[model samples]
Target: MRNFMSKKLLILSEVFHPENFVINDLAMHWAEEGCECEVLTRVPSYPAGMPLKGYRNRIYQKTHSFGLPVHRVGIVSGYQRNLVRKMLNYMNFCFLTTMMLLFRGNRYDRIFVYQTGPLTVALAAVISRMLYRQKVIIWSQDLWPDTVFAYGFRKTRLRMVMLNVFVKWIYKRCDIIMVSSEGFIDKIRKMVPGSEVIYVPNWPDINCKRVGIKSLPEGFNFTFAGNVGKVQNLRNVLAGFALFAEKNHPNAWLNIIGDGSNLKALKSLVEEKKIPNVNFTGFRPPNEMPSYFAASDVLVISLNDAPLFELIVPLKFHSYLTASRPIYAIVNGEVTRLVKRYSLGVSADPSDIESISGGFERLYYASQTELKNYSANAAGMTRNGYSKEKNIAMITSILWPSEIGLKQADLHRAM
Candidate 1:
């Protein structure tokens, strides 16, 4: 960008890391691009109720390992399934953030917020604009009431009426709205035609998997990593893996490596069903993720074919694709479309054991020639299509469009 003056940017999110979440990386990327970024977020406690080993809940300040200043906002230290409790958790984050911002700190040039918990963050943005006349860039990967409804808050007439009105208000409130995938952009456009819906795909820990591949184990070892929340349909995945193993398939294994609110129920189901060929490796550290991914033969990502998730294009997609392994996305819509467009992986039905079984069956025995081509395409997606450098450049252009004065060549060069 031509303009080099310092611009203060504040990012608000509940899942910033050393906890290893998407917003953490996104903020860090912005910092590297020379934006003066500060993150105001909850003291990290996710997946499990306990705070990450060294991180305690405090009204204190600390710097990320990367040296970006982080301002801690209070939040309920739980991930309960009770809708009321979940709402409380979300409210705890939002209200605390809003209150925290009100009484503290210098005014920022712009505000950026990550969506996951409450609509209150939108309220935070509105208040920021009201109190400081600040501009906001909202990264909304999922819609609010639609998600609340998915989590079984089936709306009554009055509740639905209020939420719909609230949503339209936020569309106008946000200066920039970004979604994680192209499918989401289309859906948002239909609702808020004049609002901007930029497609900002999440970046991966690309430093990993930059080397040559290793020899596979005697059997193909597949992995499903990340949160097994309501959005993810993992029950059918277990059943499907069992079906593959039942065929006495000489070379097949499944590893489920992560914990979430549903862990107890999912684990109990695994025991009750005696599902063979499946193993659950409870949560591991962020740095451990890269090596874990590198060891896998293929990566599996499952989300219910809910239209909301169709547009999501989870951040994990980048990690899996970057690892240069074939992916089996038990998902449809944009993710499936991208996988097919790039000839990257196989697709399977989310809730059907048969489709999952068949998908693994075909991939497990793929000819070396075909498998190599798929691997190449997945790797190429990172180097030539969605590099972090490219994403950061695009974000910079969006932020300082006049300064960049970019031509068509600069845009395509990013790809």
Candidate 2:
């Protein structure tokens, strides 16, 4: 770690402000800590491939937000559902950012790579190091190749070889690698032997207190919020919920509050099944989520039963805990482990329709006392160690121990 007064940190990510990434919060906090922070990212385009209405893909643009300087670079559009187009977008960002950094990125003392997706983004950091020799620290949210495969790409011999080589090269070059899940540690070690890997789970960005209550449809409500994508495995969740409704709870309702590529297909499935009492409320902003959670009897967090997904504890999980709502988790591995260990709620294998249906049934029939117990455990767990302040402090400790100037005891005492 270096002193904050002199150290200038550059943040690289594909998404930033106007896109609802936690990176915005991290950058703001770092700036507040006295470091001169700069962000190099593309014009806000996420969840949807088209750029936000007010922004355009200029060759290069500069602006300031939350007390930090931000550089926006050119990006290819029309990539959400098309793999070829997506690669073009990643390649375009890498090319444009690499050129800019090679010329103007020499001043930063250190660089932080916010690795969200597409390992190709590593090219920007790699180029920075090769040309400017800046130390690169990576905080990877999603593991590559496995994530790539989970996106429905077939793993061929040639493709696997290229992906492994790319992943290893990127991991080997980073000064430090921080993963958002403990389950990602072994894979990082296997991919890059001797790499310094640290676990830093995600924290909820919004406050937990219910801002307002919603008038929900007449029924026992179960709400699933956030990105309604294929990875969420909503098709199966709907199927299971349909089964649960048909057999167990006719008055049960599932409220979905988000949008994504699968939204159309999911809506189509609901219609085909004639699934009654299922409501799609589209996407809601972070601040308004509490009201939705408050309106629900149970909040759901789910994912596809992919190898990569098993390792992830989604960001929504933290928010769900903070909301103090009993969770119906259609997930496996680490997420399931946490739910079971903390007694947060019921868990089911994402691939098993019967298992998911049973989970809904179990939660629906759970005694009010039992439900209260789950909510209490969730609130208690967050207070102990999972707050946003604790998570940010943990990252600071790993990324800038000398700058923070606190020993382990001092850090704990401060928290």
Candidate 3:
């Protein structure tokens, strides 16, 4: 068998450690598994869009995380709420990373692009492929043209044509295009005909240790963890909870347990509407997430009612399932289907306040035995479909097939 450990690997991502992303854990795990891995990414300025303490926005800087060497490029600050800055942030990463790869392209045997944000970040890998002929694999967490349009971009005919062409150009260059959702495969295949597309879903990267948190209020807690962005539909979630509270679910509380651009507005809405029993615990660490989940009766996952959202499954879904909490899926499409099909929890439409209120009532009145069944079902689903060990092994085999004595055909069959 070929010794894959002798090969050097480069991970290209827009986000990494200190930014609370799955790419951080994946890189650390690869290093632990004896892979000679290094990371090239932008400086940590996510959600808040400012450099983390102890770091600066420099043209070029080097850092280390868990003993893994990290290369950082400067990013445009204040992109969190500014549209122009956000565009610049994406363009800046694409420009700097492309230039860096052009000079140091020959050092690695393969390049792995952990694509989370703009697809433009993958341009560097495409450039390296052309110049150094290195094998490139992209794990696309977000789809491009659809996301671009979904996020308030004007979809003119000319713009759509240009965007489609650009997407195809980047995707066609990669050796394999791995998608986080099965629904993405069809859309991506249509975009780049004959392109190699693989489905490699995300797993729970957080350590779910149920530590005790004394600050939790005395009530049946319904916790919403992760980013509190506009797309998360927090406004409607709050409205639904308020309606349920008005109907005399006095002991029920809604806990919003993360920070984002929409957090300030959501807090303002809470104060303005005089919403009762709603608590905003701003930006807790990932290590403390399990404790919050432990104190909760149901974990809530929601997204805006949009066609684009239906085609993607958020990473929090896996984390919630791993936490083994009864889910309250107040969203549409894929997540709702999963919750109902597996009996993991209850589902409601995100755009409908009444539906969400009804879901709350149902869960509030559910017997302890029924809630336990939901938790049990969630655990079973995680073990069977979202197993961290199994998915990571599959990824490793795809990256270094020779080490496992597997061919491309065998890998496809395994998938």
Candidate 4:
């Protein structure tokens, strides 16, 4: 076993604890294992534009949590609705994180970046590598240039050229690039040839437990949990459910859990369309997700029908699998392939409303034997394929190669 006792590590992320993300659990686990760890991140403001409770948006502040020192930088408020403020928020974190690292870059032996969005966040790590020559590893949750355009940015000639150049520059500078989806490997290699890209998928962060509380009322329930953003494609989901409810399953309910920028808009859409049996529950505590999942008859996962989205797997996939509920996947590409291959659930194209309605109909009429088989397959997949301990050990081994006695060639071959 590798001893993390003496290793000093730094984690850079735009979101951390106080805002739910897998990075929070990963950092805490490393600390408990006796690694000296610290974080450089923004003040807690995500999904919601304002600062979270017990926190004020400050220029810079230091706090400790879960045995790790956390250094936070300020972000522009009200970015949830304003495009300009959102751009500024991304820019502010990039500039401020660079400044923070310029002074303290040499303190840590290595740096790990938990990149969720905006490739610009990795610029600071790239700059640190140029200045301090530390090993920098980034776990890329989003692909740049493609993601930039996917999020509604116009791909002007000048903008495309600049983004291509910026993406290559940032990625090529990193010592190692880790991706959460296997599909990201080829795409990233196409961007930066010869770059060491490794597939390190995210494990489930939610602890699946049987709780006595009935979070949802009786009757068959289909729950969609997580952010309610445009990229989540909930509008299409709602429309499909409306079609299904009108014709086939009138008593079936669709529960939209959690909150995001699109929550109000979705509620408006529900009222505008008069979609029945649809409940919009605002944000719920992370600890309470198990109960909601436990109460659900089937879990829904969807994303916009974009090529960029095809290569990504949302963290909620693993969480839903851990809950051992059959999935109703309104998605395409990787998630769809997985669902069909493993017999985990039924799937439909995100862009096709009729197909989605058919998926709901199929799940609604599925026999108890079929549902149990799906549930058993999901539980087995979570235990065998997405084992948290195995994934974490793989990451830590790569992070401290010498401690684990892994040669560079062997590490590449292991992946």
Compare the candidates by lDDT and give the number of the best one.
4
What number of clashing residue pairs does each candidate have, in the order they appear? 0, 0, 0, 0
Per-model CA lDDT versus the true structure: 0.74, 0.85, 0.89, 0.90
- How well does candidate 4 score on lDDT at residue 270? 92
TM-scores for candidates 1 onward, in order: 0.89, 0.95, 0.97, 0.97
Off by over 4 Å in 4: 1-5, 210-212
The 10-residue segment of model 1 with minimum total lDDT is 209-218
The regions of model 3 sitting more than 4 angstroms off are 212-214
Model 3 residue 262 lDDT?
Answer: 91
Question: RMSD per prediction, one decimal?
Answer: 3.1, 2.4, 1.5, 1.4
Candidate 4 residue lDDT tens string, 227-266 = 8899999999999999998995667999999999889999
Q: How far off is residue 293 in model 4, in Å? A: 0.7
Sorted on TM-score, highest at the top, how do the candidates line up? Answer: 4, 3, 2, 1
* Model 1 C-alpha lDDT versus the unseen true structure: 0.74
Q: List the residue pairs that clash in candidate 1.
A: none
| Model 2 per-residue lDDT at 173 | 88
Cα error, candidate 2, residue 179 (Å): 0.5
